[model samples]
Target: MRIHLVDGTYELFRYHFSPGNRDREHGATLGVVHSMLQLVQDGATHLGVATDRVIESFRNDLWPGYKTADGVPPELMAQFPMVEEALAAAGFCVWPMVDHEADDALGAAARKAALDPSVEQVLICTPDKDLAQCVTGDGRIVQYDRRRQKLIDHHGVVTKFGVTPESIPDYLALVGDTTDGFPGLAGWGARSTATVLSHYHRLENIPDAVGQWEISVRGSSKLAATLAANRELALLFRRIATIDYTAPTFEHLDEMAWTGPTPKFPELMAKLGGAHLVERTENLRRHRDDDRPQ
Candidate 1:
């Protein structure tokens, strides 16, 4: 069937920042638990959630400007650990990343799950542009933005970023991700980077001189000069943008299939003031039990 891979870190950040979400200490955690239960109720069988236990990953060591837990609201940061445990109690496979970021785990899980012949589709549930690189042209793997209810396929990647999924890292490298805290080449902006990358595809593929470039770009001469002067720096940014697929994932697809909540789920929900979720989860589980072929 289909595999639903969620970016738990994004969900936590989204709900935590929403209006009235911070009033309760566990508001974000409770919000995420409700979302997961809703997913199961909506017919998701195989599902996985990846969360960043620590915001600072190995990328921080590679570049000093890389994203860290710094500046995140104290209430939001406090929910990171709680979200993972709550999702686990709700019977969802949670990949709590330590050394690697949650994006790496989502990429790894998407790639691995796509390999299973039995999997009809692998849906990575996140609007993060970085994860757009994981979408495949064949549509076997795609991204579902649960918040907006939007689906991004290979074509969507090209439409949004003006480059193919394969060139996303290169595009991000040249244009830079302010969210990830890296500045790209001085003159490079989204349109220029996308236009250049749409042709060259990768940093190394671009020629050193403007005259050497087969395609024309505005300020091609200056862009060429900037790229030539900072070749190694651009490459480093690309390396950081590329997802580390070696990040942890399940050994078997069956491990991702939801069975039911654990015994601790009720207690956990009670503590989080989400006891209503307990009834909803039980109803969903009971419905699944009745639907299963005996």
Candidate 2:
């Protein structure tokens, strides 16, 4: 069996901003529910979605610039709870995180699910670069981009980022993630950071003195000086970038199984003005039953 961990916060934001989504109030929430049903239709047996109930997490205290809900449109922010309820009614495991962000929940779930020997694969379903750090080397854990129809394995991480999965936090710390709201150290761009991190594999391990470095990087002296000067700040950024795997996800792997929609699913869809989805959900349920063995 396989486990599919979704970044529900990302999905909500995606559907909300989509050009075709015209309904301001409930379009994104309903869209996410329908999308989860489609995942079931596409043969996802065990699915779990993680959502950011509160956009301001512990990271906000660590750095003043860390992302918060201040700029998100009230219309989109209001749907967080709505989508969580809709997915729960649709029989998908929903982890609505308050202190930890959705990324942490998904990462923790992926790590937990991958430990089950019965599970063949664990797919972290999101295009977020932060989740790339969660991908495992043996291919048991990977990242899936639903929009692009792409799979990113451990090798894919290296190919795209020029560093191993374990080095992503350090890489991001140096190169910075504008989306996550942290500015990495000065004199460290993608090429320089990736080149040095690919060799050192971590922030702490990188030599403070440029001359001690074995590999050649452009402007190595300035890069080393910048890193040495702000090493503590860089580490702080890394802490913010690293996903906290301790976030509680589930007690058992079977909890993630899709057992068809709950009784309230149709009513919730109706309330959202997605009556067509109600009928579609029933058809999908019947299809699942038919596929079952006697």
Looking at model 1, which ten-residue stretch has the lowest summed lDDT? 16-25
Model 1 TM-score, 2 decimals: 0.98
Reference-based TM-score of each model? 0.98, 0.99
Please write out the lDDT profile of model 1 over residues 83-113, one tens digit for every residue. 9999999899999999999999999999999
Q: Model 2 over residues 228-279: C-alpha lDDT tens digits?
A: 9999999999999999999978999989988888999888888899888888
Q: What is the C-alpha lDDT of each candidate?
A: 0.93, 0.93
Clashing residue pairs found in predicted model 1: none
Q: Name model 1 segments beyond 4 Å from true.
A: none
Q: Model 2 reaches what TM-score against the true structure?
A: 0.99
